[model samples]
Target: MFTIHAVDGYIETLYLAVYEDRVLLIDSGCRSDVPRIEEVMKRRLNRPMSQIALAVASHTHPDHAGGAPTLRKRHAIPVAAPKDINQWYAGFSGGLQHKIDIMLGHFVAWTLKYPFEMIYYKKHLLYDHPLKEGDRLPGFEDWQVIETPGHTSHDVVLYHAETQTLYAADVILKVGSGYRPPFPVSMKKEMRESIEKLRHLDVKHLLMAHGGPQQVTDFPAIVDAMLKEIDKGLPPGLKRFRKLERFSPVMKRYYRERRQAKKAS
Candidate 1:
């Protein structure tokens, strides 16, 4: 049996699956997270850095993949990431509108929280192996990689049918008692389809990158809510505001405070 460790980071969580005196790291956190990750390895897992046989980046997002380059360079660990990561690694790709949307949402939000990390992401870090659906992760024979793109075109989720565990990555995020997609879903239709795929799975444990572990029972209602939103397309004004929320740190803080106040009330 492998032990799973959730290493908390600035705004992301890195998962480590340990088995047979070796570790498989999922999502390497940000640029500055290496030392903390090492600390977790030495103190918590009682393992050396060399025991990290393989590392997988759930997607190309900085929080998930920023430490990948360091892992590769320092530990010489092999990394498996989405093939399409190169498209957005350097910067944005696709149509002007698409680029603008992502820059306003994901890019701006990341920069607001981790400026130097963002710079490191764009300038450094080269993804190693390209993973896709049906690919079995090395050292984790039971866990099967499944494409779960929505947050990003390259997002993938890991499923272990024997254990009924789903390493959902950012596909399903825990919000209070329920789950939801992270803000500024770039491909709504694809995201919905991915959620539908997960809905059919006989998952008992739903593990996420951002939120820690969640109950599978909490997923159905969240999926239903997301499907309802997908059916009702975003209004132009609301879309604009969502993008603006990413760009303006003040707006983000205001919304956060407002939500907290509402919950308190």
Candidate 2:
């Protein structure tokens, strides 16, 4: 077992697990923060970089996988990621939109009192291979990959059926929680369906990518909340905003802030 290392103020986490002297690092932090990540690694592992056996990302989100290239460049470690995330990662091609995306990320971070580090990657640094649901990780045999889309079409969650533990990416959470982000566009129906799918799983300990892991009980209640929103529409709070048409201005402001964050970064 390895402790989750929170990355910078963004509240991102890097997973570290060891087998003998071999270490498995999951989802390195953003590119701008790699030095701090490496420093944290050295301090925690009390060993050099060569000990890392493999690195994996739940999806292609920069917050989750941005540091992969740096880690790979330094250690030549194989970076494994969901097969479906290539396009999303590649969507950040240099342009006005890239800046807008960066700004948007930063704005969200600011509102959350977290600073998002902009991620920059080399062309060759894109993932070299794809990982699919049900594919066994090289060193982690007991863990199974399960597709858990909602936040993103390519999102995935890791399930250890024997342990009844789930690394649920963005599909579930206990902290740093609330509304979903505005991008990848909202798929309220899909999100609700995904939540229903998860409710049926035998999950006990749920680990969200952005929050601390927690024991989940009353799974049906959470599933009901999701389904209710989907069948009826967004929650009351969101609905109130919509009825007053107050949500539009707030959403617009949020978008503007995001654009600004990108420029500042």
* Cα lDDT of model 2 by residue, 1-265, tens digit: 4444444425465566555667766665566667766676688657677877777777655566767888788878787778866544243232333344445446657877864466654422366557776877667766677776655566777777776777766665543344232233234555766777777778776665666556677656756754554556554544432322212222344458768999999
Cα lDDT of model 1 by residue, 1-265, tens digit: 6867888765667788888878888777776678878999999978899999888888765567777888889989888887766554342222333335434435544754754333144423476677888888876777799998766667898888887888888777765655557655656667899888877778877778767876665556666876776666554645765553232232244458768999999
Query: Model 2: runs farther than 4 Å from truth?
Result: 1-9, 89-99, 114-118, 122-125, 175-185, 226-265
Residue-level lDDT for 206 in candidate 2: 63
- Per-model TM values vs. the true structure: 0.77, 0.72
Q: Tell me, what's the RMSD of every candidate?
A: 9.9, 8.8
The reply for model 1, stretches above 4 Å from the true place, is 90-119, 123-125, 229-265
Candidate topping lDDT: 1
- Looking at model 2, the pairs that clash are 102-262, 103-258, 103-261, 103-262, 104-258
Candidate 1 versus the native: TM-score? Answer: 0.77
